[model samples]
Target chain A: MKIEKEPISGQYGKFKIDGIDYRVYWEEAGQGIPLVCLHTAGSDGRQYRALLNDKKILEKFRVIVFDMPWHGKSSPPENAKVGNYKLSTDFYISQIMSFINGLELVKPVVMGCSIGGRIILHLAINFPDKFRALIGLQSAGHLDPYYDISWLHRQDVHGGEVCGGIAYGLMAPTSPESDKFETMWHYMQGGPGIFKGDLFFYKFDGNIGNEIKKIDNSKCPIYLLTGEYDYSATPEETKSLADTIGIEMIKMKNVGHFPMSENPKEFLKYLHPVLNKIS
Target chain B: MFKSLIDDNEKRSQLSIMAQYLNTSFMISTIENEYLVNIEKGVVKNVEEGPFVMPSYVFKLTAPKDEWLKFLKHTPQPGSHDIIAMLRRKVLKFEGDLHPLMSHLLYFKLLLASLRPVENKNEN
Candidate 1:
C-alpha cells in the first residue's frame, strides 16, 4: 500500500491540558470501535496515515491519531524547561490521559511504536481500565541487558554512523526505486538530537519494565509485536517480556524496527490476527 | 603501437558490451576506499573498478570532488570488483543523464546477478 498524505481536520484542535498546548491530529474512518494510534517519537501521527487510510482497516474501525508534545505540528511546551531535557514518561502519560479524556474517547485500543509503544505500556500500567486492548510495535518497555548502558558514548563518538546504520539498515535490499526509497528514508529520521532524546527516555532506568510488571499484576492484556532484526530490542528480550508478563508476542521475520514502514503487508498479516482476538 | 590499436579496438567493444550489460558508470576513490556508480536512464555505465568495500546507501555521498580526484591520483588496476561494490554503496556521488541513471539504479540487482564471475570448473 502507498503512504498517502491526508490533511488533518481540527477535530480536537489546540487545547490546553495542565498548561501545555496539545494539538491533536485526527481522522475518523469506518465504524466499530475507536482505535487511538500513537506514533513513534519524533514522528507525528502522519506515520500511520497508510494504516489509517487502509481500506480493510478503515472498514473495521475508526482510527484516531494525535501528535505528542514536541512532535509534528504539535505545540511545544509553554516552558522551555520541559523542552531542555527529554520528555519524561510521566509527562507523556499525563498528556495522553488528558488527550483521551478531552476527546471523550471510551477506553479505545491504544497502539504505539517505539516511544509510543512505551507510552502504551505506561498507560496500561497506570490506567488499566482505559483501554480495551493494547498493541505495542517494536515496544521498548522490556528490560534488556543491552539497554542498561547509555548510548551517550556512541552518540559522541559514532554520531552519524550509528544514525545511518539504524536508519538505512532497516530497508530491504536495493530495488529499482532506490532514490524514492532514499527520500522516504530521509523523511523518517527524527533529526539528530530529537532521536537521541527519544532513545534516552526509552532506556531511562528500569521504569518501563517496572511499569510492565505492575500492568501484569493488574491483568491488563497487551500484544507485543516486533520484527526479527530489530537490533534495538532483541527477540530474546521480547520472549522474556512475554514470559514475564504472560502475554502473547508475535515476531515477524525478515523485518526490523519500523516493520509497518518497511513491510506493511507482512505487518498487517500478523497484526490482524491479534486485533481479531482482541475484537 | 600496432598491438595497442588492436587492444583499444577490443577494449572499445568490451566497453560497449559492459555498458549495455551493467548500465552504470563506476568511479573509484582509492583514498576513501569508495566506489560510486552512476546509473543514467536505466543503463549501467562503467563496470571495471567497482564492487568495493564502502559504506552503504549510494545516494548519500559524503566525499568532495577535489578530495575524490586526489584519492584517484594513482592509475587504477583493472578487474577490481571492490571498487564497483564500493560505488554501489555510494562512497562517491555523481550526476549524469537522469533517465539512464534511474534505469541503471533500477537494474542494479539484475546487473549484479549477471556480473558474477563464472566459475572456472576446468581449473579448480
Candidate 2:
C-alpha cells in the first residue's frame, strides 16, 4: 500500500515544570473519544501523521500526537544535568499528564509505540485513574534474557563512536532510504551522548513485569499486541505477561518489533479487538 | 570461582567437542549466514563476506545503519565506515558455517556468561 504523510496543526510551545522548561509539540485531529498517541524514541509523532489521515478514525475520536522531550520538535534542555537524567521518565509522564489536564481531555485512550509504550505502561501503573484505556504497539516492557546482546557488546566496545553497530547494523533494516525519511533518519543518529545516556536507562532494575501484574486489579483494562517474531517481548513473554496480569492477550502473527510499521496488515487484525475493547 | 565450578580439562574438552561437531555437521562456505542458540550459549554471531543479508531461521535484523553513521560521524578515520557502508549496501558478501560454527562460538560465550559474577539470584 502507498503511504503518504499528512499535514497536522498544533500549538508549538513550552512549559516549565519542576524547574525545567520543556518544549511540547502537539497536534489534534478527528472528533470522538479522544485518543492520544505517543511516538517512540529516535522519531516523533509525525510517524503517526499518516495513521490519522484515516477518515474513519477522524470521524471517531479526537486524535492527539506529541513529541517527547529530546525528540522531534521537542528540545533537550540546555546544560542538562545528571539529576535531569534521573527524572527523564518521571518528567515525561508528568508532562503528559499536565498536558492532558490542561486540555481537559477526559480520560483519553492513551496509545504508545516502543518507548512511548514504555511511558504509557509506567503511567498506567502509577496513575491508573488518569487513562481510560491503553494500546501498546510493539510495546517494549522488560529486557529479555535473550535480549540481543551482540548489539549491546558492539555498542559497548565501540564506545558510541560508530554507526556500524547501531545504524547500519540495527537501524538500517527499519529505516527507509527514501528522501522523505532521510531527514528524520539523520536526526535519529544526531548525538551519541544521548545514546550513551540510554545505556543507563536500560539499566533499570525495576521489574515492569511485577508492575504489569498490578493491572489485574486496575479498573482500566490494557490491551497489548505481542509481535510473533519480536525478541523484545516475544509471544511467550506476552503470554506470561497476560497470565500474570489476568487479561486477554492478542498475538500478531508473522510480526516483529515494529509490527505497526513492519506488518501493518497483520497488526491491524490484532488491533481490531483492542479498538473494540476501548470503544 | 568459575574455574573451580568446572574442571579446566572438562571445559577444554567441551570446547573441542563443540568445534569438532561444527566442523563436521555443517558446511563452511563463502556465503554469509547467522545462527541463534537458546542454551545459554552464543546468542548472536554474524559471518559475512562481501555483503549482509537476512539469513533463514535467525532473528532477522536489518543492517544497523544508524549505528554505523553514529560511528563514522564521530570517528577521525573514514576507511572503516566506508567499508561497513559498502557491506550494508551489499557491495560485499560473507561466507561461514551457520549451526556448527554457532555452537562452537557459543561454547565460549556461555562460558563467559557463566564465569561472570551473578547479578541476579534468579539466573541459572
Candidate 3:
C-alpha cells in the first residue's frame, strides 16, 4: 500500500519585474481557461494542493497554484524584515496583478480565500475589465475588531505555537484533528510578524465598504462565497456584503475561513455549481 | 542615528497613524532602566527617563532590562520576544489601567518595536 503519494507536478520559475526579483513556485495541470488560485494571508498556495490533483477540476480548468512573496516556498523580498512588514491595499493588489501579468494568463477566473477573497472585490473595481470573474471565499467588505497581536512579534515568545493556536481558532469548531493540525502547520512556518502584516491589509486596507458599489460586474462578475464557521468573516457578514453590493453570496457548510484547505471536498459541492455558472 | 530616525518628520507621521487615538502617557520600564513616553492624540511629544513619575499616565510595561535590550536588537529569539509573546511566557509584565494599552495595542507595539532598528543603527 502506498502510504505517501507522490507530489503533483508543475513548472516553477523566478522572474523579475521593475528591478525586483520574485520566486514564483507554481503548479499547473490539465487544460481549459486558466483558473488561478490565490491563498489567504501568511499561507502559500498549498491551500490548493488538492485541487491541482483533483481529476475533475483538472478536466474543466487549468488549475495553477503559486506562493506569494514572503510566503510558503517563495523567497522574501530583499527588504521584507527591515521594519514592521505592513501590507496595504494598493501593494496587495499590485502583487496580484504582477502574478497575472507575469504568467501572462489570459482572462483567468481568480479565486481567493480570506485576504485572497477580499482582494477580488478590489480587483473587480480597480481593473474592472481584466479577470473573467472574481470569486471571494470567506470574504467581507472589511474585518473589524482586529485583534491586536503585535505582542507576538517579540523575541521571547514561541512564534510557531502562538501563531498555530491563533490559526486553529479560525477553523471549524468540529474540524478533524488531522485537518486542524495541517492548517496549524502553515502558520507554524510563518515568518515573525507575518500574520500581523497580512492583517494590516485584511483589517485596515481591504475595507471597500462604499466602494463595493463601484465594482462593474458586467466587466467582471463578483461572487462572494463564505464558510458557515468563519467568525472573523462570518457568513452573515458576507451575506450582508452581497446584499449591499447586489451580488450573490453562497455559504459552504462544514468549513471555515480556508475553504479549499479546510474542507475542499465539501466546498466543491458549492464550487461546482458556481464554476458551471461561470464556465 | 536612532534619535534622528524616530524624530524624522515624515515617518513619525506614518507611524502615528497607529497611535492616532492615544492621548496619554505610558512607561516602558526595561528593568534596569525605563523610558516614559508621552503622547497627545497620537503624536509622541517626548520620551524621558523612567523613575520619572507622571500622575496622568495610562499604564506601564515592565520587562527585565536585558530583555528589552535583546528585543531591541534587529533580531530576537523565542521566550522573550514580542510584547504579547513575552506576556504569554510571563517574562514581561504590564501594570496600571490596561485599557489604554489594550485599546492601542498595535500603536504601542510598533512604537516599542520601532526601537529595534535604532539599536541596530547604534551597533553599526
Candidate 4:
C-alpha cells in the first residue's frame, strides 16, 4: 500500500502554569521566523492545519500551534475538578508565556483568532517585549452576548452539535463546503461547557476597552484582520478598534469568524502580504 | 416554493444526523405571509400557508420581508447571513419555546439555509 505523510510533527510536553501541571500538545512545521498561532474558543490548534502545511508559508515562517489544556489532545490538569474550566486573563497570559518559555521560542510573532484574538491584545499590553508582532483575527475589545449561552452547557441539548451549529453561521456562505464543515467539526468535538468557559473571558473577564489604549503599536506593531461576515466580531467592531488605536484594519472579503479554518485559501491570500511585511 | 424545496428527498437527507429524532413544527413569518412547516422524524411532512387565528407550532421566527429577501439571497450580506446573525442584529424575532430549536440547531439552520436561491451560472 502506498502511503503519504504530511510534513508536520506533533509532540506532548509538560508545562506548569500557576502551579498546575498540564500535558500540552503542540504541532510544528516549517522554519525561519517563529510564528505561534492560537486557535479560536472551544476549538484547538487543528484550526491552523492549512497554514501549517502551506509550502510558501513554510518557506518563510516556522509555524507552531498548540492546544490549550482541556482542548484537543491536551488533557486537563490532573488535579482539576470536572466541568470547572474557566479561563481568566492572568491564567491565559501565564499559560502562553509558560509555553513559549518551555519551547524556548524567542520573540515569536503571535497570532490568534476569536478568543485567541482577544488574548493577543492582553499579551501586547502586558508583555510587549515577548512577541515580535501581534496579529488579531476577528479580534475586538468587547463583544455583546447575542444568545443565551445557558443552552451551550445544558443537559437537554447536545452540546457538541449545538455548539457546532452556532459556529456554522459565523462562516461566509461563499467558503468551500469541506473547509466550513471541518471548522464546524472542531467545535463539535469541544468538551462540555468548554465554549462557555472560554466565553467567560471573552464576554466578561477579558474586556480590554480601557487597557487597549496602552498598547504602543510602534513597539509591538498590532495588525487586526476581521472577516466581513463575522457577526460576533463584526468589521465595524474591528474598524472601531483600529481607529481607536490609530492603526489600519484589514477587512477580509468572503470570509467570517473562523477565517483560518473555514476558508484557509482565502485567508492565506490576506495573510501572505502581512507575513511578507513582517519578514 | 419553500414547501417544495424543503420537502425534497435529497434535501431531507442532507439534514443533520440528529434530525432523525426530531419531530417538531415551526412557523416562518415574513411581513406579509406566514408558512407553517411540519417535520416528523426529519422528513418535511407538510408546509401550509396561513392566516390562521391560532396556529400550532413549537416556535415561530418572524422577520420583515426585506430581511427575509436578504436572507434568501445566494450570498447574503453579513448581518443577514444566518438566523443567529439576524437575531444578534434584532432583525429576526424568535418567539415561543426555544428548546426544540436550540437542541437541533444544526438541523434547523441547514433547513433554513437550504431555502436560499441557487445561483444562475449563465448570468452575464
TM-score leader: 4
Candidate 3 predicts chain B with a TM-score of: 0.79
Q: How do the residues A184-267 of candidate 2 rate in per-residue lDDT, one tens digit apiece?
A: 353344333443333334325323755676664367778777665444444665666667767767776655455545445556
Residue-level lDDT of model 3, residues A184-278, one tens digit each, is: 78887888878778888898877877888887777888888887767678788899888877877898776777778877777788888888888
How far is A86's C-alpha from truth in model 2 (Å)? 5.8
Q: Judged by lDDT relative to the true structure, which candidate is superior, 3 or 4?
A: 4
RMSD of each: 12.1, 15.8, 15.2, 1.7
- Candidate 2 is scored at a TM of 0.59
In model 2 chain B, the worst 10-residue window by lDDT is: B74-83
Candidate 1 has a DockQ of 0.04
| Tens-place lDDT digits, model 2, residues B1-59 | 12222334334345444333232312112223322322223222223332325333322
Clashes of 3: 11
Candidates in order, interface RMSD in Å:
14.6, 13.0, 13.3, 0.6
Comparing 1 and 3 on TM-score, the stronger one = 3
Candidate 4 regions off by >4 Å?
B121-124
Candidate 4 clashes between residue pairs 3 or more apart in a chain or in different chains = none
Ordering by lDDT: 4, 3, 1, 2
> For candidate 4, lDDT tens digit of each residue in B9-38?
555567746688889889989868888999
Number of the candidate with higher DockQ, 3 or 4: 4
